[model samples]
Target: MGDQKGEVVGGLLDSVRDVAGLPECRGICKIMYGNLVRRIKLLSPLFEELKDGRQELGEEELKGLELLKRAFNSAKVVLISVNQGSKLYQAFHWDKVALKFHQVTEQIEEALSQVPYEKFDIPQEVREQIELVHAQFKRAKLKVETGDIQLMMDLNVAQIEGVDPAVLKRLSKKLQLMTINDQNKEGRAIHELAIASGNHGDKIFEMSSLLRKFKDCTHQDSLEFDSDEGERSPLKHRSPVIPDDFRCPISLELMKDPVIVSTGQTYERSSIQKWLAAGHHTCPKTQQTLLQTTLTPNYVLKSLITLWCDSNGVELPKKQGSCQSKKPGRESGAVDCDRTAIDVLLKKLADGKPDQQRAAAGELRLLAKRNADNRICIADAGAIPLLVELLSSSDPRTQEHAVTALLNLSINESNKGKIVNAGAIPDIVDVLKKGSMEARENAAATLFSLSVIDENKVAIGAAGAIPALVSLLDEGSPRGKKDAATAIFNLSIYQGNKARAIKAGIIGPVMGLLRDAGGGMVDEALAILAILANHAEGKAAIGLARPIPILVEVARTGSPRNRENAASVLWSLCSGDLEQLKEAREIGAEDILKELLECGTDRAKRKAGTLLELFQRLDAPSPSSLEQKSDA
Candidate 1:
């Protein structure tokens, strides 16, 4: 309300100041985010409109907008950089933090490359406004570029008191003898001040407070020095922190079966294996071809990591193998996918040579993919374990074929138990986490089918399936999104998994899909939302997703199930809440619901009738319903 348009850039710089001052402690990055995300949120619509309407603007204005666009994009990259580092810091790694910084700077450079500055023809009043905003923006940019990191090792506080030249030299030597571990924030601040002011034993708390306000620091992940004990003190309460370089760049995970590449970069063997197996022969960092195709075992790094984990009593991540070839299976002519052919493929997959196994897996994959009867045929042939074994193969193509075949096979209720019993959950989770996009979709869909078995639900949750599925809903191909939503819908049937699904940020994407999605996906997404909306968290998340109008539109015009689901979801959200009922009225939802009540099935008719009765009772039009009206 207070000059939002005028304060856009100014607000950005102020937000940066607040964000930069936040401590680089675990969970603090979450606090540092929303500022930039909010700025981008405000500017996005304005930027889009300007870009789409250059014909309505003068060339100079268009140019100004372009420069502003570059600035905004650069800020977004910086935000992403901070976001990546936040995730890294939460794990207590600093090397990746440095790498994230380098990558963000590169992105910023690319973002601003198209900035036009030659003879800009903006008016003086507008130009004055820009210069005024630019002054603070430039300073903030400079501060970020030349970040203020005062590492305690480099801080020479002994000479800061304006002490004497000769006797003070001896004094400095003696002062340096009283050492503090730089990693101890309180101790470092105490040392800095005692060396500077020369007489304050009680100043540790005061200085630590100041340091927290003025600086962002990496707190030791699990270890800290006991401040009173001077010599090699161990933390009384905390565990030991891992070394910064222990994680693979590709996976951002701890190295297991560490391997050094031709580029002299060490990665978790499985990560680099997956990379190489995905068909990129070049180094991920240097882009140089690994002509020799060798990965030397980094035994020293592995030993050190092992020693650290052993000393700290921390369990290491599971050791996983490298990836396989990415080449897809050849689509052959239609096969007579009867019971005999299915048995032949299953035997070959189970007992044939590697080449024969791969071919059989691919053919079974194709047969399963062809139709439901073939899936039943393959299931009847007892192919679950063979297909599950192929899922663990190094060849990505083999893994994809195996997982997809398992998914197709899992469509049969009898095959699901066999799939789960054959130890398919972990391997399926692995594919969901790291497979090709297509493989990931198949894995998600397969997990949904397998989870239908009551026993397998716990296994899927334990295997960490929710986030991976949510990611697909957030950003995936159309088919992938549909499957991911269906997966969430299936998984949410268990009460414990609902909180996990909602916490993974599922509501927003599912609602976003509802805005444009079609067919069974809309039905699937709504079914999930209906359950989510029953809980307080679900209702709040649905309100935040802002899809009531879209739901209203769907209620007015969609398939029977969609109309019923939409009407029911709206009725759930509005029931026992007058404000929500008022919103329903304002969005033309009353009219839609009346129409739905008159024309819809019994379930939709009942919900619409109830929603309308509530709206008629409440006179206040809700804010969301007003927005929905304008939106519709």
Candidate 2:
């Protein structure tokens, strides 16, 4: 029992010695044996006493060792007294202040470092706040590192708490001095982060995109608002008015190719002027303002009137006021002479001077050829009868010019019967048989124009014009041959004249002219042959004489125009006679017919097809024979 008590007493002594050695207090102490020792003067002694079976310590015995252990273990109670005592010591000594601050900084850093960085999913606003906080923390850290205590103090605790760990690490120096306001901390942080990341420019671009979106949104809103307003909005309620017959009522499309009518209204050319003049210009459906302008006669109407006057052999209005000024100058004179030549010509005509009359008439004929209007005026002024009389003259030039002038006057179909009645055809034919190339060509052209009318064709054919034209084909000039061929072609278009042409022995010469110097003559001759081939008398004449060789040559080696005409002739021949089918096939007509059928004009193709069909039908075997062969 004494040994255990002694052991407990020794343990209590060691605990008291350990507590006394702790540096809980600061003081001057003796340096004994190179070790500084604090002098802790004990005011009480150790003693032994009994109280409720607990031992009481006696004076000067160091009996409070167990109580010291208990107090030290109860740090909350003992730390308050220690802090109070340290504050009192610190008031008297500034050296301990630095050490206290160092300890405080170490504690704060350790606590901040322990904060969990990865625990929370940061909202955008919270993330921004953290960025701002980090920026502030960096600034504060920089200032604190440079020993700017005032700046460090200015930084708030909230700023440090809000700082994102990543941002805090990135800009630790700037973040160190920043203050965070709880109210606007997130916004400020976002702004700071945006500035640091150079996203401010991107924000401006985003603002522009937002403005555009706003504009589109506003437009849509306005439309909806307008629609909601219903009829109150004029723009929403009103529709553009258009006419029922909005078309030009002329062209029936929009108003183009406009012309005026006598009813004082503008309409497109497709509108009938006469119908408009008769008060039919307005739209049948809508009586809106379809009138575009005031009316005037179209130029074509005047042209048609002029054409009518010229065609009927009527004289145009003479330039009366100043004949000399209005008359073409001597340099522009077609006759290569003056009015003196006319006087001389009139004298020769009166005196019956054949050679002189012929020369003067030839001059007039040359002038007339140069001016068609002059020829018409001369004919209308009764020069035609005088020229017809000159056709009986012995001089060929006299007869030639006389016939030429007469031919010019006879161009009008209305004048054709009259010219024939006046014995003009025989005179013209006589001159054509002996006339110069120019005279013959002019005669042929005039005859051709006249032959367009069926009455003129009969009159001319009756007056023996076919033989004279055919004679010109044999001995005429290139132009003469062409004109003669053309006239013959025109004559053949009339079935009555076709028989007459054949009876006049004109068919052979007309076919011969197909190989003439002029390509036009060849085309015209082929055309005449084609026309003749359509008539029974003409076909009989062609079949007996057979112009097929000439036509075949033209088809094979002629110009496209010639080939076309040749094809037309072949078509007419095949249409008139099935016997010509074998002949056509023998001439390699099948291949040529196919080419024309595919590539020729519509008319040519139609004719070629007809010919091909005719050939096929003619070549087809009898059904009775086929049936018999099948039965066998």
Candidate 3:
């Protein structure tokens, strides 16, 4: 009989742990079940107290354990139900879920009250914890959270009254559903709930209606947004992408009347007005509280947008609520405009005179830098071949503009392949070696951007860009050195390029930067060394530079990220190299390791802990010494 009671208590403890291990509920469901989860987790330690002493329990205590087990089983059901339910459904039907919480709380409280502590072998701490949990459940049973009730009422009103934006702003804040990512998560939950409910209910209908209204007020509509002209124009296929800066951050549509808010972020006048009317006292784009809510007209951006529209043949959007606005799909004029502009520039590069080529290259550079869409447009217009041709032009300024344009265009991921396939690496390398300083800086930067593609790392290395990059790092201007450091860091990520970089004499410049405390390149230098330290030859070169004291100083005093990277580099240096480990210990790295173990970033703390353990292990007597001590 005692054995059976022990087995029962052990099984109940397992059940309690399982309930405590369930994932906590989220959003409105979290508000309802959060306290209940806490209560169940508190009971885990209480059950643990009974695991070894289960045989000492009498029948009455066994009955109490059984009662608590039943209550915990009930809790597990409720937790699973809420975690799997739709956030929207939970928000709308919060009262029904709250009832489940109230009932489960009462059941658990009653079951805990029956556990006679004096009759059992449980500790005083476990008894007190269970009692505290019982009292909490007792209070929770009668407590009605007025705020949760109000939130539920707001959600219902939104479902019935077509979503007042002011109420929506309040709901969004209360529910933590502010970002687009949050809305998408709720949408997925709603879809899952609809599928589970077989899609035929008033509740699903209400949820769908509320979500639709919420999205319509928040997200951008299609190109036909506010325009009433519904005709499908033939030019719909050629509608140009609007520049992101010209569009309202709120509505994501072209701003007819741009206004600057207190935060200096610009938005369309109507969109800002609607946001203010919705009782939002903060900027939509920045979320900063408004100082005065004054809308100052941004004449400069308005003029630039107007000039762009005029040059691209795109129609300017009309004032809010005005008739005769630009028709949707018919305003594909910008598309045609960009195509024409790019073709004319390409033609100038191919056959125009020297001045025309330089001017055209400069224009293409600005166009590529303006926005992502323009980068695509410029590259799609077949400008890479012409630009590569100009990389070696005898005219220095034209070469500068040409390489810089390629640099800007390479910001788009797809254009990396295009630039490489156009046979630009050798020309870019040539410019890096011999062009004017600014041109060489940009050429190095261009190589860095292109080398982001892993395959280009090898090609750029084979084309001898590493030597030129090393030279720039050693002798170029401040900006040039930074660019070269970044390019070398990226190229050296490949196994083959690490050797090439070492052969090109990268260690001297890197060591110089490390030793120069005021050079502002310590971060970049240490970052590159951290990567290079993993390679054998590169590691040997860095080791010969005698980097322990400097690295220890950095680990002791650098900024958080710098300290983290310094720790990483130190660990790489000392991991398999006993001489390096002894050198670090001798140079006072042990005290810094202890400091880092306490206050460093997570990765830094981990590396510091491993190094500290290694140091301790080294300090401990060996097995042979221990045996000798025993003999003595």
Best by TM-score: 3
Order of the predicted models by TM-score, top scorer first: 3, 2, 1
> At residue 304, what lDDT does model 1 achieve?
92
Best by lDDT: 3
lDDT of 1 by residue, 1-632 (tens): 22332333344444444444543332222322443343334333333332333233445444454455445544554454443321212222333444444444443333333334223344445445434433422332212211112222212332244323333233222222111232233333233222222112223323333222221122331223454544556555444444547855444346778899876888777656645532234465443335456999999999899888888887965655222232122113222356667777778888898867876887787676545457666776678877877877877778888898887676555677888888899989889888888889999888877776667877798788998999988777877877787677667767778888888888877876676564335666777888788777788788766667888888987877678888888987887766666666788998888888888867789998888778766766879999999999
lDDT of 2 by residue, 1-632 (tens): 33433433454444435535555432111011012012111200121111112432333222233333232223222222233221212222323343333343333233223323223233445445434433332232211223223223322221343333333222222322121221123222322222211212233223222222222333444567678898787556322221212223322222323455433444444334322222222332122112343455455644554454466554443422354475555334533434554555666766755655775676566554433345444444455567778878776657667777665455333455556666676666656666767766667766765665566677777777788888787777776777777677767666777877888787777766665545445555666777787787777787776766667677766665567667777777777566676788888887777887887655567777887887788778899989999999
TM-score of 1: 0.43
Residues 1-632, candidate 3, lDDT per residue (tens digit)? 57757666777777767766777555565655777877777877766777766447777887887788778767777777676545677777777777888788889888888877666677788888777877877777545577777787788677666556888767765665665666666665664343222212346556655665565555433334433335554333334556768866555557899999987899888767645542334566544346578999999999999998898789887765563354343235443338788999999999999978997998898787655568777887899999999999999989999999998888766788899999999999999999999999999988987886778989999999999999999989888898898889879879999999999889989999988989888878997898898898988999999999999999999987678778888888888888999999998999999999999877789989988887888799999999999999
In candidate 1, which residue pairs clash? 222-239, 324-394, 324-395
> Residue 342 of candidate 1: its Cα lDDT?
71
- TM-score (C-alpha, index-matched) for candidate 3: 0.49
Error of 2 at 276 (Å): 27
- Name the better of 1 and 2 by lDDT: 1
